[model samples]
Target: MIPAIGWLLSSFLVAWLSARAAIAYAHRRGMLDRPGQRRSHSIPTPRGGGVGIVVASLLCLPGVLLGTAEPWPPRVLIGLLVALLLVALAGWWDDHRSLPILPRFGAQLLAVLLFAVASGVAGLSWWWLPVLVLGGAWSINLHNFMDGIDGLLAQQAMFVGTGLALLAWGGGQEALALAAGCLAAASLGFWCLNRSPARIFMGDVGSGSVGLLIFAFTVMLGRAGAWLLWPALILSSAFVVDASLTLLSRFWRGRRWYTAHREHLYQWLVRCGLTHAGGGVIYMTWNLLFAAPLAWLAWSHPRQALPTTMGAYLAAAALWLLLKRRCLRRRSNKDRHVAA
Candidate 1:
């Protein structure tokens, strides 16, 4: 308990201080995100604040492993760290200068493939290997997509990390639980600077690295049989639903899905008079009121996990459609008023 508490505190402080430093450095370097057509803010703000998050998480790795009461295999830890660093470096590069989609995606694919190979995912089935690799890459990109709003990505990270920690701890996976706990603490510290009326932006580095970390933790838990995939999916239903539905919507309309736009439900909600913080709170509320309970049920009852997960996603899908309809209706009404 003492070591765990120490780990959490140290991680939080490191992230917090690092974020402050990142803000200063970004401003000094003139790495600012100016308000634009597709943006949510009015004033320019410092970007790459997520460098602090990435740095803090990396710095705390040794302590997280050492402080764990139950030891993890050295190989597993080393592999996961290598994958994280790779993704973070790639994301950091993108943050500084936009990389072509193919190269950026190639980097993500390579990192995921490395992680899969390191984790012995090939033994599951040769076919499953490609699916996992692609899925890992999607997770990274989806997370980066969702980081558009203030506090949204950071808040979601906190919820997911804390949820993972609780589930792993309940399942007696102490090392995994500790890692998740550290993730939550780091996110919380960053969230202080990331919240609405934001002083800094997380940029690609924080979001991409966090997405990979979540994927890695879920895989680790699955390998340990401490939890199955269903609960993890349920825990992340909010992001899964939003990102998946939005992508499908764009693809169906024959829009260049890779292009950045403010078409996400969360973005629509923002356009409909919700403040950045308000939009973030709404997402956090969904996770707490809807996703969290269902995830808990799935985690606690393996036999019912599948049905519970399906039900959870079904509800999430319904909510997504409803939100879309409402946002569309609001836009239509505003258009009519403009025509008048």
Candidate 2:
């Protein structure tokens, strides 16, 4: 207990300091995100603040692993750590210079494959193996996609990490719980600099690495039989619903799905006059009001987990449709007024 508390404090401090340094470094290097057509912010802001998050998490990992009482297989722990490092490195590289689509995706795929092999997915049915690999890779990318506004990604990380920690603790998975706690603390630290009227952005470094970490934790929980996948899905329903629906909508319209665009419901809301912080608040509220309760029910009643999970997604999907319609209507009204 004492060691865990220390770990959390250390993690928070490390991440905070790292983020501060990253902001200064970004400014010095002129690694600023300039305002553009698809952008949400007006002023240039330093990016790659997620470098702090990635650094802090990795630095604290050894202590957390050693201090925890839970018995994790050495091989599994090493494999996960190595995979996370690879993903973080790739994201860090991309933040400095845009890697082409194929190379970027290839890196992600390679990391996911390492994760899958480490997690012993090969023992699963052939079909399940591919599904797990694809899902893990997609999870990493979807996080990058969702990181378009201030505080959104960081706050989401805090909520999901905290939820996972609580769930793991409830299930008596001490090691996993401790690790998740550290992640939550680190995210909270990052949020200080990442809030609206932001001083710095997380860039791909933080988003990609954090996404991979969450997916890895989910897999770890499954392997331990401490939690089911449904609850995990419910916990991150906001990102899942928005990213999935937006991608499908784009693909259906024959748009280049890989292209950068501000077509996400959250993005539309920002364009419709919601401040960046306000946009983040909406997501946090959804997690508290809708996703959190359902996640709790799923965790407490494993038999009902699947249905509750589906219910959460359905509600999120409905909300997305509603937001999209409202955004479009507002645009149409402005257009009509202009014509008048």
Cα TM-score per model: 0.96, 0.96
Per-residue accuracy of model 2 over 85-175 as CA lDDT, tens digit each: 8888888888887878888888888887777776674243444567768888888999999999999999999999898888877777888
- Candidate 2: minimum summed lDDT over ten consecutive residues — where? 120-129
Off by over 4 Å in 1: 121-127
Q: On a 0 to 1 TM-score scale, where does candidate 2 land against the true structure? A: 0.96
- How many residue-pair clashes does candidate 1 contain? 0
- Which ten-residue region of model 1 has the weakest summed lDDT? 120-129
* Clash numbers, per candidate: 0, 0
Q: TM-score for candidate 1, please give it.
A: 0.96
